[model samples]
Target chain A: MFGLRYLEDVVTLELDASKCTGCGNCIEVCPHAVFEIFEKKARIVDRDACMECGACAMNCAPGALSVDSGVGCASAVITGAVRGTEPTCGCSEDADCC
Target chain B: MNESTRNTGECCQGSSTQKPVEQAREQQECTCQPEEAPHWSDGSIDTPSGRILRVKTTLTPRDHLGTWMVHWGIRRMRYKITPGLYAVGSPTQQSPVFVTANYKMSFDRLRSQLWGRHAWILVLDTKGVNVWCSAGKGTFGSEELMRRIQAVRLEEIVSHRTLILPQLSATGVSAHIVRKGNGWRVVFGPVRSEDLPRYLDAGMKATPQMRCVRFTLANRLVLIPLECVEWFKYLVLASVVFLLLSGFGTGGYSLERIQDVGLRSVLMLLIAYLAGAAFSPALLPWIPGRAFSVKGAWIGLAAVVVLIAYGLPGPGVFDNWLEAGGWLLLVPAISSFLAMNFTGASTYTSLSGVRREMRVAVPSQITATAAGIVVWVVGRFM
Candidate 1:
């Protein structure tokens, strides 16, 4: 992550502090260490590092996390836009989806 | 239909005799081997659950070849192993059961790391996709894990209810749900299979470094082949089209002009492709942009400058200024689009970030390409 940072302030990740049970699931699920426990509440420490994979939101029992999660591939976005479907890693036989 | 086939059809038809259907399903799930392929495993072992396939800790020459071939997008989608339980070494009831996707690359990487160790590999049906991508698509979700566990009767085969899953699979698997619903605790493993030995020896606790994903130079380099392969056909087609188009001129169709100018255009395109797909990714960190398109454009511009200095398009061009001007805009646009495609392979790019970049970059690239083409065609006529 030191040299691989992407666009700043573009991640859709948001945390409703009141909904956090301080379960630390977000911290556990995040591959980027985007979350931290502060005063028994989940806080987004490195907001820009969040890839919005939806793992933290899915694993969070209290539903404290929310983000418009999807594959971060430009080709997928282009294909999905053309096909009028949700962004998908190309699943065609010839293309290695993802 | 045969007895098993008819019984399966009846099961799907909601037949009243459901017990046989359940038994048939269990029987199939237990022996997950395909009828035509026996090479899925190295050998077989007798276990309490059934006769489980035994896999080797070391990969074969064929496996290495297959890995290399897949990098070039050859037979990549079909590269899969049978999804079920496999034995590595001589695993016992107390042995660790690691779960993974059915992609042969994923399976091979995991098993190869387990040399001289006894372990049980529980392969999930992900339609040949790797763990991280399949997990992102829900193919490696909690339902699939629970279903596989029930189908294989894992409770009977293992003495423990713990499962070790790759940390990246957390995108689809809800550890809390797996534990709460079926009592099988999911312990997420390291982000890479190579770190598995250290993870197990540390009593299954992963350090922060193990959890984080890094796009190292080697990782970035390995993906370059696929990018080249993906664009190679298009590059050829575009070159041919430009060659034929170059024959048109104010005097008449001239083969000599086409040979000189069109051939030069092909070389420029190839250089642009390499700059975008090869150089841009290899020099990603040093490239001065958060957006991949911008990074590619910078490299493309540099490549174009080198070409111009080296006297591209030759001296006999209908108009040297027009031809060079068109190439200046065209090469960078082509490079930028190809570079943007790497967002899928990158580890840190968010969906929002990619979308934001594409929104601005794509339209600009399209405009540049259209303008460059117009200018280039005008130069050919002059």
Candidate 2:
């Protein structure tokens, strides 16, 4: 999965290693290989790879992971700003706005 | 293959004559016929549930064509596989059941990687979107998952009580609720479908590498075609408007006047498009700014320098230093606005970050462009 590796470091993904249960959920849920387990705890191996999708944090039962995740598109954010609503990519579960 | 099975497979094929959307609609209607239960083709064996089409794990020519069309933003809404249970190879009651979106590209990516393996694919209707995007929209949420499971009578078809879902879909699905409601365990798989084979082989355990998402240069490049195509109409309109406006400055509508100012303005616009939409994305990683608008402005500035060096727009196009400065400001501002559109496709941006960027960038872009136009008009007429 080669991507714009340099730009991804801007993602605000943070891992509270102290709260990790070492169940490896974050390691499994992250698509960017952002975390690695070391010494029975999860570590941020490649911080630059995080897409800020927040899959790891959602799957983490121990609440060891957190990130400010939402639609990342500029147009969506602008639309939200103009419309005065939470920014959405329009791919809501009930309607196919694509 | 049985007649019903063959017809079902034909429904999945790209129609040569009909519009893609019409064809998809017809296919969707076709699948609804109670007698024509969906089935697989290519040496697939018949099962009690339906025909399990034995399919190769690699992409076919049709699949390649579909991917190419999608890249160009052609009939993208029509590019979906019918939502239902599909079998890859010779799946049985004990085979693993994987859930995904009905977006044809996503389905192709998953099935293509599973060559020589047997599995049951349960595709949920996400209105032709891929899993990750649909998940964010909630189409690939727990409710849909549970609905598909029941609709397919999944409990009866597969003996196993576990369902494998993409890790990216976790945001929309509550694993606890699904387990509590259905007595089935939800196992989140790796981020990429390419890792499915390895994940399955390793007893459903994803390695650290498999979980990470990678947006390589190739991924960024593929998004460019669609961006250019979608924005092309606007680009053409902008060029025409600028050309007309350029003719209004100084001289009346004359062949010489049109050629000198009109053509030059249009040329500048084309350069803006190329710099903002195409070059900015291709040179994404190497660009100097974390913000996409800044990167686009840099590219636009570079283009302006080259244009001035070559004197391509003609010396009369800008009569004074103020007019020249106005062109410089306008070019990069247009470029910046266009480049900002890529934030949706980018891998690193977050909602908060994008909001913050837009709060500042959009206003600045609007002001720069407005001021540049005012300066140019003043320099030309006054």
Candidate 3:
């Protein structure tokens, strides 16, 4: 989105436990004091602070890290759809682009 | 260059934007430069001198021809790439660092304003896609930024550790983690890059009102011509299909004058395209209701009025009206579908909010479009 929201849920880093394999990859990767190990699994100490990028998922061995990822830009989808191209959004071409 | 090496942030390279409404009322006159370059192509200087400092850029014949052409083809009917970076003039390290994609349109909007600013620009490798879409795909997120930071040696360019980002990009970059991992603090910028000057002058802080995204009529309207361009080919194809189908529906009489039907079909399509892709974005905010569909409907209605004024014809036109109405319904639904998609482009709205809107909006569109088709087919005969 590259657009900023003033309400300070500014950034957060979390792992979905149901999918997590208790891999410590995120803890190893993060530079901020955002994540900590708990019960052999990594947890987001500050969920409201997530920035919404997909780094953990990239390095996570088990593919357990999943966040509602994607740059939420409206123009991108409209641009994709207007071309008769399938939208690059979570929904189908006929669906909302975001 | 290479696909894997695309994360270098070579194309765009920037960060978050500042909100507009908040800046207008702030009353703080910034000592920065006073005239930002025009937002986009009016054939003016690429960069302006306003408090907004546009990122410097140079386009050679070499960048990405195929990719640019493809993107151009895609946007022929709608959508655009505002390439370049910008700053509200005289920017310093204290100016927030914003990031965006190299879609050209996005890049230009970000940097073309800062003539002599010193803010860090971090362009992610969306492979030519813009920010929000790229973020959704994960190309504009943390891994890419970190890699770009490493690749570009961003630390060497700026003294500040804070990297402001477009709010829509949050899905890709986890803030807390970036600070821990890259030693760079992530700040969500603004929804529109034009607001950068006002934002920088206001102590680098965004008010709650600034963060809200409104897809006003002006917002929706500007997108129309671009949308029409994006779908030009589709419109041609649709015209051929409609002409052939209407002839078939008539069984014989209208068969000989295939040219007439073809022209009419194409005209209908033009109207639809203008209404849906063109008019839709222009009339966004003023169209009515919070939902994009309603906004598009308003535009579609306006397109219908345009059709009436142009003399579409008599009962012979009822057949045209059916085509027209079908398009009216169909286009806005398409526009609404497209406009609703803008959520990813702005600072407001979250992933969950988007998902929620889609859940409700999609089913409604599906049903409406299906009905429109049915009525259209029925009208062709009766």
Candidate 4:
């Protein structure tokens, strides 16, 4: 496993120890090695390694976990929002936008 | 477009969408697949390291250089060119030098647009990824740009200290840092290559529109496929599950009612995806709010309104009710998900902005989807 300090990108999750339940879910669910468990509570051992996928926070039961997670590609999000349908590729079966 | 030929051509090809590792894997497949580009003596480039780089593509007429039709065709089909640095023409001292990435399509685009222009293309080793993704990954950042400049000995090839970079690459590569590190100036050009000539002719000033990022309907529409493709697997599984459950609840283990699951899912999925990815982008300014999730939610509600008016049969129509229920939650949840995806795309969103949005939006999304699914089940049982 990459050391928790391996943050290659900015992360959204930060543990407010005052708020954390020490459930250790953030450390468990993080795809990036962004957190570590210390004192039965999760700590952000590496923020830069966080891709901000939000899995940890979503899986967090006590709401102690948080992140600004989502797909980062602008085009994908834009296309998805407008069509009221999944965004289609330029070659997606000849719809008007496609 | 025969299946085999398409397969051969496709594998031999590259995409900006693929990550570096994925691209590397695909590149390997290019040589291994049959009828792969036949430019080389057995249609493959076998490196000493046992890695395969499909360097050979079947020759095409000179209307464009070797195999560029495939390049252009892919660009047109996808509406997205691979990002990277490339060479349009060999340049010596006093010749213009352009920088890009190994995103084959982006390389092809810059060169193809240059047409008859003679320029040196400095291909930065973004590990064969496109310029934008490379930028996000820091491959297009100061260190990599500086490193690539050094590796290419670009200073030797051009008398000018200026290297033209794509406008979108500005986020990761700090121009000041690049200049300080490499003794070269970074000049950002237009977002599209066709504007390169105008940009250069105008002494490297990007027109207002060129600098502005557009989320036109066309742009949104083109990106829909990648979204759909990803959901394709989940879609299949979801539909199967929904159908089986619906059958048990409504028709006692039947296929006729099962197809409705697919239809409902397709419709709901499409509405939400389009609202978030396509409609939101196209109507961003008028989406009623600054927050992407809120904007997506607005669009999602509008979708519900539109579909309710257009597709629903009657008050008690069960299928219509299921669809409506499906969309009520699906649309908002999808919009939330799509909006969340926007964190990486927009220039304005900060880590805090994104984090705050997620804290509120995720639970709402889950609640909405759960509620909609429950409604569908209740309606079916009723």
> What are the chain A TM-scores of the candidates, in order?
0.88, 0.81, 0.50, 0.64
Q: Which lDDT tens digits does candidate 1 get at residues B185-220? A: 998899999999999999987888898888889999
Model 2 stretches with alpha carbons more than 4 Å out: A1-20, A36-50, A62-66, A91-98, B1-40, B43-56, B202-205, B251-255, B311-320
| Prediction 2 global C-alpha lDDT | 0.72
- Candidate 2, residues B222-265, lDDT tens digits: the string is 98887788678988998788777766655555566567767777
| Per-residue lDDT over A1-98 for candidate 2, one digit per residue giving the tens place of the 0 to 100 score | 22354343467788887888898767766666678789999999887556667677767777888887776787777656666977665432222122
Q: Estimate the lDDT of model 1.
A: 0.82
Better of 1 and 3 by lDDT: 1
Residue pairs of candidate 1 with colliding backbone atoms: none
Candidate 4 docking class: incorrect
Tell me how far the alpha carbon of residue A15 in candidate 3 is from the true structure, in angstroms, after superposition.
17
Model 2 chain A: lowest-lDDT 10 consecutive positions? A89-98
User: Local error of candidate 2 at A92, Å?
Assistant: 9.0
User: Using Cα atoms with residue i matched to residue i, what is each candidate's TM-score against the true structure?
Assistant: 0.90, 0.83, 0.54, 0.58
Per-residue lDDT tens digits of candidate 4, residues B15-42?
Answer: 7576645554444333222444322212
lDDT of 3 by residue, A10-94 (tens): 3333467878777564554332224667888777774543434444555565666765543334443344456675334432111
Q: Can you write out model 1's per-residue Cα lDDT over A1-98, one digit (the tens) per residue?
A: 22688999899998999899998878877899998899999999999988878888878888888989878888888877987988766543222222
Ordered by DockQ, highest first, the candidates read 1, 2, 3, 4
